[model samples]
Target: MALKDKQTEKNKHFIASLEFALQGIRTVFKEERNMRTHSLMGVLAIIAGFIFRLTTVEWLWLLFVIFFVLIIEIINTAFENVVDMCTDFHFHPIGKKIKDMAAGAVLITACFSLIVGSIIFLPKIWQLFVTYFL
Candidate 1:
């Protein structure tokens, strides 16, 4: 193919790849309960950020931790699927260990996000309470 044709083909492939990724996200969201929960948490965090009127740096930190937890959860889900496939959905100690580790990763990231969220929001919440309730 010509150089211009190759560039056009690459662009087409990039768009198609993005579509495939989006489709995967949709499937995961539909099939995985944890994904739905994580998505809900992310939405709640966004709402809290708006309510608090977070500063730009605080917004960046909040968004980063939210997405970090979600990305880890997605990876954990993928690991679970792969482990299940590899073990033929049967009992296997190694497979159990792999799945456990993946879950632990998700848990750790979630805890990290919780800590970051507390750091960012607790003061705002306290101030609001003090201003209104005290």
Candidate 2:
């Protein structure tokens, strides 16, 4: 009976964690403009991948990049917000550097995603051009 109760409590904790995660997702979608933009870009990327008839592996790679960039952007935004909330315009150099570094991380992820997309799609695009024009 004690084991059963412990298992039930664990299940309840898992549910609560899920609820918290859902609330965070809602907050991001509702409060963060960049989150919305990233979501829109993700949708567009999925549509384009389908329209371009990407192979399963290609689609997987594209989706992986897209999700990675968006996740990093969200983390960067969260860090910036936390830093801003902690210091309200005190001109703290460390805080500024931390925020800048977070933004740089997002930028690096975005650039890498772009490179991955190009690597995955450029050959297919070139082949299509040759097939259509030559």
Candidate 3:
């Protein structure tokens, strides 16, 4: 009986935790410009995937890279917020380095995502252009 009660409590906690996570996502999307940009790119990717009729493997790769980029961006945003809080929004060399490093991480992930998108979309786009124009 005690074990069952514990399980029930855990289930309730999990649902509440999910709500908190969703709220965090909403907050980030609302407040973070980069997150909004990434989200727009992700939406475009999904639309292109449907238009191009991507294969299962290609879809998997597309989804993976999109989420990976978003995840990294979210982490970068979180890191920036924490650093700002810690530094009280003052300029410190270490704080600048921290923010720069976090930004670099987002840049690297964005570049990687762009490369993946090109690899997946360029061929299809070229084919479509040739089909229509030539």
lDDT of 2 at 118: 85
Per-residue lDDT of 15-89 in model 1, one digit per residue for the tens? 999999999888889889988998899899999999889999999999999889888988998999999999999
- Backbone clash pairs for candidate 3 read none
Against the true structure, candidate 1 reaches a TM-score of 0.91
TM-score for all models, in order of appearance:
0.91, 0.82, 0.91
lDDT of 2 at 53: 91
Candidate 2, 127: how far from true, in Å?
2.5
Sequence-dependent TM-score of model 3: 0.91
RMSD (CA, angstroms), candidate 3:
3.5
What is the lDDT ranking, best to worst?
3, 1, 2
Top lDDT prediction, candidate number? 3
lDDT of each: 0.91, 0.84, 0.92
- Ranked by TM-score, the better of candidates 1 and 2 is 1
Off by over 4 Å in 1: 1-8
Specify the poorest-scoring 10-residue window by lDDT in model 3.
1-10
What is the C-alpha lDDT profile of model 2 across 1-134, one tens digit per residue? 67665555778799999999888788878987877887887788788788789898988888998999878877887888788888885768899999899989988987888798788777878889999999
